[model samples]
Target: MDIKKIAVIAGDVIGPEVVSEGVKVMKKAAEIDGRISFEFTYFPWGCEFYLEQGKMMDEDGVCPA
Candidate 1:
């Protein structure tokens, strides 16, 4: 079995809404594979955040705490 890390940036308005469905499908597909898994990390940095922080993502796209 193997684990995969997926970094998703559902940036701006409808981005999250659309990505959610895609993720849902991917999850189901992963389940059928049975030997692979997905680890999703959502980064809350987008246009709204950029308005406040002036950056779309971190220097490396990592979520800052």
Candidate 2:
């Protein structure tokens, strides 16, 4: 089976709720297919973070090399 990487930024309170449902559906679909797998990396970047830190993400959410 192949592996897939998914970067998730659950922005605000409502964003998390929506992202959870999406993750659930994807997991169920994967189970039925019995194929590719997913690796999710959650980034805590959003309006709330901005309000506290004055930025939505670190360096505009670009992953460093």
Candidate 3:
């Protein structure tokens, strides 16, 4: 089995929408190919988050600390 890992950070504005569409397409591809799969990890850190948290993200935001 071949699996690919993807990290997604929906920053703001069209970022989420674009990522959503990409994920949908990738999922379809994976579904069609049994040997191929994807593992998606989402990180919530962006401009909108900064407005509320006063920072774009924590020091280890990417690593989820």
Candidate 4:
């Protein structure tokens, strides 16, 4: 089996709802395949965050370095 890492940012308003459904679909696909798994990491970079912090995402924004 293979493992895949996913970064999820469920933004404000409808973004959260939409992201939830998309995650469900991905999980279903992985289950049916029986060969791949997903690990999701959630971030707080959304409209609300922007309103509060004046930035949509972090200064680094999940960068790998």
Candidate 5:
């Protein structure tokens, strides 16, 4: 059996909270089944981040390639 890693890209304020809840649910389900593993990465990018960087994530915040 192979375990798949999931990547969650949280974009803004509410994004983090929503993603957190989703992860919680996944954990519960995995605990019940006892056969799944997950990896989560949080990217901090939003209004506050834009204010600091002077650019949005879509622009130059992250390079495409």
Candidate 6:
């Protein structure tokens, strides 16, 4: 059986905290199943990044995966 991949894109601020909890839950589930697996990815792009970049993610027009 092949394990599925899980991609999570979270903005800055509370986004990281929230996503961290979610990843913990998924990891627990994978352990219980003893087969399923997941790959979690968090992207920190929010107000701070926008301020530095001089634009919101939308303004940058970078497409999200």
Top-TM-score structure, candidate number: 2
lDDT of 2 by residue, 1-65 (tens): 87788988886666899998898888888888889778888888888888989977888578665
Each model's lDDT: 0.85, 0.83, 0.85, 0.90, 0.71, 0.71
Report the poorest 10 consecutive residues by lDDT, candidate 2: 56-65
The ten-residue window of minimal lDDT in model 1 covers 56-65
Tens-digit per-residue lDDT, 21-65, candidate 1 = 989998999999999899998888888888888977678775565
Residue pairs clashing, model 6: none
So what's the TM-score on candidate 5?
A: 0.60
TM-score to true structure, per model: 0.79, 0.82, 0.76, 0.81, 0.60, 0.62
lDDT of 4 by residue, 1-65 (tens): 99999999887665888999999999999999999999999998877898999988888895875
Clashing pairs in 1: none
Choose 3 or 6, whichever is better by TM-score.
3
Query: Which of the numbered candidates is closest to the native, going by highest lDDT?
Result: 4
Using lDDT, rank the candidates from best to worst. 4, 3, 1, 2, 6, 5
Instruction: Write one digit per residue (lDDT tens) for candidate 6, span 1-65.
Output: 44776656666655777988888998998998887888765454678867887676545345566
How many residue pairs clash per model?
A: 0, 0, 0, 0, 0, 0
lDDT for 60 in candidate 3 is: 76
Residue ranges of candidate 3 with Cα displaced over 4 Å: 63-65
Stretches of candidate 6 exceeding 4 Å from the true structure: 12-14, 55-65
In Å, residue 56's CA in model 3 sits off its true spot by 1.8
- State the lDDT at 21 in candidate 5: 91
Could you tell me the C-alpha RMSD of candidate 4 in Å?
A: 2.0
Query: Taking the tens digit of each residue's C-alpha lDDT, what string does model 5 give over 1-65?
Result: 33656757666656877988998998788778878766675666778778998766656445554
Candidate closer to the true structure by lDDT (higher is better), 1 or 5: 1
